[model samples]
Target: MRSIEDRSSGTSGDDGSSGDSIADAAKTVEEQPAFQAVARGGFLMGGLVHVLIGWMAVRLALGDSGGSADQNGAMAMIAQAPGGRLLLWVGGLVMAILALWFLLRTWFAARRGHEVKAAVVDALRWSGPAAVYAGLSGMVLRFAAGGGSSSSAQTQSATAGLMGSGPGRALVLLAGAVVIGIGIGFVVVGVTRRFLRQLERSGALSVGAALRITGIVGYIAKGLALAAVGALLGWAAISADPDRASGLDGALTTMAGLPAGVAMLLVIGVGLILFGIHSGLRSRYQEM
Candidate 1:
């Protein structure tokens, strides 16, 4: 065999080629350092929050509604355990911390780039906490308030524990509003920067442009859904009678009570589900 330096794995320009490869990779990364950095930051704040919400919704759907927040009967299931209570408070703190981290991350992104939009940065500064805290309320209300679903056993599934009456429903509504505000903040900022388009141009993806679009749009839609859900819950909390106990019954219950307003909320809910479907389908083919 020839000497090692002359071998195929160690050709004449091996060292030179290796150096060039590294330099090229580094140059590519630094070219859009700001965008890459912001993507990480966004993942921390908003992306993490969305993941948590999805988890919560899935859990709630599966009969693990956490606390009795909306479950009159099941309240005892979680509250009876002292450890579970502590776990809840810890969960809330974790969520709040992540939210705060994201807020600061965006701020830092703008600061680092020296050219980030002032308005987008400012909007990010406020919306993270507002949306996160509103999300936390879903848990607190469940564990602490013992949501007041109606006596019917089946109605217990969809109802939030803390949202059993007029005031409670009102709080849900406000939470929805905050969530919507946060979503709009993201959509506006993302569009202004042409975030998704730029990524594709930069060769950051392999495939699924159409699917990625669906996912991105779905994310915004989810934000809108949060607002609508909050509003509907808020209305239900206020109008829902403890004695009336709508339980886990979803939009149908509201429609029975407030035909006009409930009708509108139901439409919003349907739109949200459609977005969810879009997201789910897109996720089937997405990479990250």
Candidate 2:
């Protein structure tokens, strides 16, 4: 048998080799051209969603109540278009791939040998996009399967169920707080122009002014919308009124009822469209 020191050295060597192998494999996958392409498609799908939602919001601002101004509404609108089902399926797969990409990024960040706190922060940041993309993929697939549900209705139902129990109500409030934090984060990212960090340096510089304008307007609008959603959720928990817990559609509708809401909604609508355009640009220039 080997001596104790020799045994420890062998074990450490084995662990290090295994870790290096896994890291290399992950990096390889991340660098694959096909994976990168799919991820870019995901960005376009996201941009399309924002564009549709913005259009609906603008229509609402003009007193058109044709549809709900949310993701479900957007999905429904697509379903009515020619070849929409096939498009939904393709979009769903792309978004799922993108979600996988984000998850891999999160894994890489966590294992990058950075300081523990920094690694954790980086992992958490990537995980947020992973979750968002995954949720969007699910929404798309649900519609593709012809089993889509109204987002506002789902929000209200979930809120009501949670409000039925003490722990659940607490959980709802916590969720609301988390959403608000995310919204604030979006605003920060926009105002600080931090999103440019994810793009290729050369590409970003080429369209610097256009990218800056659209990104700022888009992120701020999205952040405000999310903030409204969270506030309404919190209010629902406090008032024991789940009806007020409708998602984005409800948030926009509520805003419309306020004084000068039409103008506000119109501005937010345009801002969201600009955000969508920014996402489209990101699809081409984002760092894979």
Candidate 3:
């Protein structure tokens, strides 16, 4: 019979080996060419969405009452176009795949033998993109199914629900703060040109100036938009008015009502388009 100490040691070794095997498998799946291709397609799909949203924003600024200037608006616009539903389905699938890839990356990052703090940070970084892509996938699928609702309406409804309770209002406030933090992060990334770290050096250098310009403008615009969104949410919580929490569409609309808001919207719209262009480039040049 084996001694208890010896058996315990063996069990520990087995567990360690099992963990290593799982990590290795995850890394292998991540390295697959097909997976990378799907992820790149996801990036392209996201870029297309951003471009559409920007166009809608321009239309809004130009006094076109065509659609809401947000993701739902973009999807609605796409749905109206020829073969749009099919495109939405495909894009939804790709986004789902990309989200899965990000989750895998999060797992890999956590198990990379880094210090606990570093691993946690790395995992958090990957997880944010995972959550974003997953949300996008769901939105795309919802529209692809010919069943969708206004983002602003959904936002207000949710905010109203949360505001109905004290703790819920606090949660909403927390969420707003988190969004603002994310927006600030985007600005920092743009200003610092930190996004280039995810691209292939040679590929990034090929269109260096254009990439840099678009990336900077796009990030700042996105950051500003997000900040406005968070601020609106916070306002809604404070004033107990859910209508104040209308999301991106509302944020833009509110900007439109400000003095020189049209020009600001136009700049933001153009910047978003540039960001979409940057995303397209990233799809091609991103380090898998």
| CA shift of 17, model 2, Å | 3.1
The runs of at least 3 residues in candidate 2 whose Cα sits more than 4 Å from the true structure, single-residue gaps closed, are: 1-11, 203-206
What C-alpha lDDT values do all the predictions have? 0.42, 0.87, 0.87
Sort by lDDT, best first: what order? 2, 3, 1
Q: Write the per-residue lDDT of candidate 2 for residues 1-288, one digit (tens) a residue.
A: 333334334567778688678879988988999989999999999999999999999999999999999998999999899999999999999999999999999988877655667778888989999999999999999989998777778899888888887788778888888778888988998899999888776534558777888999999889888888898888887877788887999999999999999999998888889888999988988888
Residue range 154-225, candidate 3, lDDT tens digits: 889888888888888888898889889999999998999988887777634558777789899999889988
**Runs off by more than 4 Å, candidate 1:** 1-100, 106-211, 237-288
For model 3, what is the alpha-carbon lDDT of residue 110?
70
Ranking by TM-score: 3, 2, 1
